[model samples]
Target chain A: MRVLGIDPGLTRCGLGVVDGALGRRLSFVTAGAVRTSSDWELSERLLGIERGVQSWLDEYCPDAVAVERVFAQHNVSTVMGTAQASAVAITCAARGGLPVASYTPSEVKAAVTGSGRAEKQQVQAMVARLLALEAAPKPADAADAAALAMCHIWRGGAQDRIARAQQEFHRKAGTARRARGV
Target chain B: MRVLGIDPGLTRCGLGVVDGALGRRLSFVTAGAVRTSSDWELSERLLGIERGVQSWLDEYCPDAVAVERVFAQHNVSTVMGTAQASAVAITCAARGGLPVASYTPSEVKAAVTGSGRAEKQQVQAMVARLLALEAAPKPADAADAAALAMCHIWRGGAQDRIARAQQEFHRKAGTARRARGV
Candidate 1:
């Protein structure tokens, strides 16, 4: 599956697209941040991001979008900004009808580095190793986005299996009930 | 000056823009929400919000953007989402280079109503009366945003005066030092 991972921000949104199947090598399609002009108003900046995301979607045409789950911090002002950034990401994904999955920082780190408590540098190193890139992704946010996509791919297959089993069980139960005509 | 107040959210961002000077009249702006689809990834949703805010900024071009400062909540997930929303607004403001101000919910309510402990409806009513709006702004988020902007205007003006006084004091001290030549 082709996955688009995102690190949401108000001024800059880091995006990484990875394409692969389960237990296979994943390829990076594109990754970068969309930055808004300082002179533009909030609305304009938002629109800039919108257009940027649209272009990315058009280019990648990915099957799913992965985003980092929000994490709370001590700074009130910072928290407010992070919330808005998340809204922007959610709206964009919905508009495209792309299935969106969220990965917590800990989960992403664990998937990439095999440890939830892995430091930033460790996570970056692991991402570099997994992707076999010459160096780690620039701007930690981008690396985090890539890691989220990787985590989703690894865990998504298991989730799909569980969902399928549940569906089959429910279908069989319904069939049994219909047969009894009770 | 025209000031725009923002109540940033993951699903919705309530905005209210008003004339800041003179009688503090309510302008043509009102509160509106931008919603993202649940299916989309969080990153896509955040990018959508960035576009929305950018649109708001471009449309209004408010002299300043005022946002409500949020504290940590009991729910880790909810609080984290709120923080991301806040980040969207702050980053957008910074990108626009507009003076961004923030106020606590209590401060906003106190400014709109006489008491900080006022209920949502109470604060809305006072905001309508204080700004001379024909009716209260629809949705509590909108009212809160307007209240936040109003608080900033009041508080910002006071802060400016205080800053001027401090500058004057410093200037006097410098003059005295030069006269003494010590």
Candidate 2:
């Protein structure tokens, strides 16, 4: 299955396309960063990110989309932007009816490097080795996206099933609540 | 001029439309909340929000959009969702070519109640009084939205001009940076 991974940020959003499934050799399709001007309003910058992600989705048509999950524990100033940018990508993917998953940085590193606490260079080297690339994708964000895509392919099966089950359960409960007119 | 105000939240996004420009008799167009099921995934909830906001924008056709500026200092568990939801609305507004402005709770309260520390009930009362409504809009979220729209109308002139000026400056700077091929 083909997967698109995103390392979301307001100023620089990374996109990586990988074609593979569990137990299959992964092939790199493309990797790059979508950069937006920090000078722009948050709304405008978000619009730019939306357009960039849309263009990638249209071009790659990946079977699933993976985004880096953001936490509130990071730098106070940048965490909000990271969350906002991640939201744009996630919502856009949902709008297109694609299944989406999010992975923490350590999850991606662990999936690709076999160590949760792997260093950045170690993850990069492993990603390059796994995809048979001469070197890891330039732009650290792109490499991070590649790692996320690989993680989804390796660990996403169980994660996606759990995610869907939770969504389905919530939907049913919501319907029941609405039917009771609450 | 008409303004569409949004109080962004994942579970409930408040929307209010008001008619009037600065120094004019303000009229209420509508006030309501767009509720989403908490059971859905973040992306799904966000997509729901996007659709709800889009429907309001299509029906209202406001000259500008006003949204609450979210801060990361609030409840840790919900602040990220708030930021994400706010991004969806702001991005949707920008995509539709609507000018969008964000005001903090204090700014809205100060604009409507003459005090930033005014109680929520006081702000609601002022909104009802300013709009000549029989009572404050039901559901506190909707009232907050109306107050936001009214705030935009009463204090939006200078704010909008400054926002536009900043955007223009950013656009120009961005162009110069690109021209320099940096």
Best by lDDT: 2
- Candidate 1 regions exceeding 4 Å error are A10-12, A35-49, A74-81, A180-182, B1-6, B9-21, B24-125, B131-142, B145-182
Q: What overall lDDT goes with each candidate model?
A: 0.74, 0.92
In model 1, how large is the Cα lDDT of residue B6? 84
Q: Cα RMSD to native, each candidate?
A: 7.5, 8.0
TM-score for candidate 2, please give it. 0.88
- For residue A62, what is the lDDT in candidate 2? 93
CAPRI-wise, candidate 2 is medium
Measured with C-alpha atoms, the lDDT of residue B51 in candidate 2 is 96
In model 2, residue pairs whose N, Cα or C atoms come closer than 3 Å (at least 3 residues apart or on different chains), thus clashing, are none
Top candidate by TM-score: 2
lDDT of 2 by residue, A1-182 (tens): 88999999999999999998776789999999999999998888999999999999999999999999999989989999999999899999999999899999999988988889999999999989999999999898999998898999889965667789999999999999999999
